[model samples]
Target: MVNVNCNILQAVDKNLMIADKIFRSRLMVGTGKYETVQIAKQSIHASGASIVTAAIRRLQINHPFEEKSLFKYLDWNSLWLLPNTAGCTTVEEAVRAASLGRELCKKIGQSNNNFIKLEIIPDYKYLLPDPIGTLKAAEYLINKQYTVLPYIYPDPVLAKQLEELGCSTVMPLGSPIGSGQGLKHLDSIRVIIENAKVPVIVDAGIGTASDAVQAMELGASAVLTNSAIANAQQPHIMASSIQLGVQSGRLAYLAGRMNELTQAQSSSPIIGISS
Candidate 1:
């Protein structure tokens, strides 16, 4: 078996799969819904995550001084921005969104090969990814020399398909988006992780520190969380918790786990009775 290795763990690798590089951070964060950009930056720093997700939006210049860029306040040296096609519902839309992201990144003096978080969600309420459409987008983008990291359901087959299409990584939701329900499809996630040729990132529905730890322990390459930490009373502290959780999980996985037992064993000695 190929052993995992990183700064936080000995046997588990926390390297994030960007276009052609492997980033050494397992904690991926979103740049959304923060009270302020400062707070968001602080939380990101606290999380110790090297990669942060950014959404691609059309250029709307309401005012000359109006800052519409999310990357304005974030520390670029420490964090690599992973632009996402969050609101796209179709393959065409997703492709356009990713192109827009690439353009925007170039306009802002960022790398062109930055990874794209392909999120094709048709339904507004559930926010579930359109897996078929996502695959389409991934195929196109990968062909176009873009680093694609698609967010989809915990489907092992989908992961394999993405890998074959030359995607850098596949992000599967732990549960519904923003639900904070933790890992429900844990078994499926394990299957995806086990079979994937690329990195596997646990994307959404992570509520607490333990949730992140659980995902990492199951051999997931990394995790992306936002609501659970950003919505907390103390977001900075919560970010630290998430960082620790990722580290803890990676360490535990490296340490290896005890097998589950079907029956309980008697600890007390029954030597006299047996004799």
Candidate 2:
């Protein structure tokens, strides 16, 4: 056996705080659209993500197959379950879904059940989140003492409004959901990250590992990805790659990247070099 240096791999102090809960991993994966629960579990475990999102609409209360239940494969002790209102089209529906999700969590004995990923997308064609309805639902949920993470367009003004409304985090989309466009509204997202007091998470349009890195380098507190990994040929490997990408981006950000220059400059000692 060869001796290895473990100090180099020591954990960094990059804890993500949402409401009162703390998570060490910044990458949040979705448990949807996978071929099987085993694949989803393996991918999630390989990704090293502490938080995973589940669609409340898809979760079956009474199913014929026990393996089909998400709870069956997940290690509830380690992973934080973030139930999302994926298909809700209105404020009322979203609010009800959130409440039901909380109740389900309670029934399942989950500790952090008050967290919700609020989404209200009435338009099916574009699948764009309805900002007005999202705001309304967020306000309602916040009033009800829920730690709401509202998904909205990459609009700085709207992000600020959500922060003002006491949302735990504001998740702005890079592009439309599942489009994999990869940060189409970079300027708007930058503005939101710069101005918002709460955490900013890039919620969608991540096509690959580079997309996740770009989002993190742009100062996003975390990133939530679903289709990118789920649709991959080998999801478990993709998940691991994405986790590395996120880690690299976060380290780069913490290292204070150099400023961009208009012209190139040489790094040699001109006086010592021969003419």
Q: Give the TM-scores of the predictions, in the order they appear.
A: 0.88, 0.94
List, residue by residue over 1-275, the lDDT tens digit for candidate 1. Answer: 12222343633443555557767778999878788867887888888888888777533322212575556666566667777998888889888888877766665557655568999999998999998898888888888888888999999998899888899888999999989999999899999999987888999999999999999899888999999888988998899888888888878887899887899867797778854
Misplaced by over 4 Å in model 1 are 1-14, 17-19, 58-69, 265-275
Worst 10 residues of 2 by lDDT: 1-10
Provide the overall lDDT of each model, using Cα atoms, as 2-decimal numbers: 0.82, 0.86
Q: Which stretches of candidate 2 lie over 4 Å from their true place?
A: 1-12, 62-65
Clashing pairs in 2: none
Q: With candidate 2 superimposed using the best TM-score fit, by how many Å does residue 91's alpha carbon deviate from the native? A: 0.5
Q: Report the lDDT of model 1 for residue 181.
A: 98
lDDT of 2: 0.86
Candidate 2 lDDT, 79-139, residue by residue in tens: 8878899999999999989988887677567855799999999999999999999999999
Candidate 1 TM-score, true structure as reference: 0.88
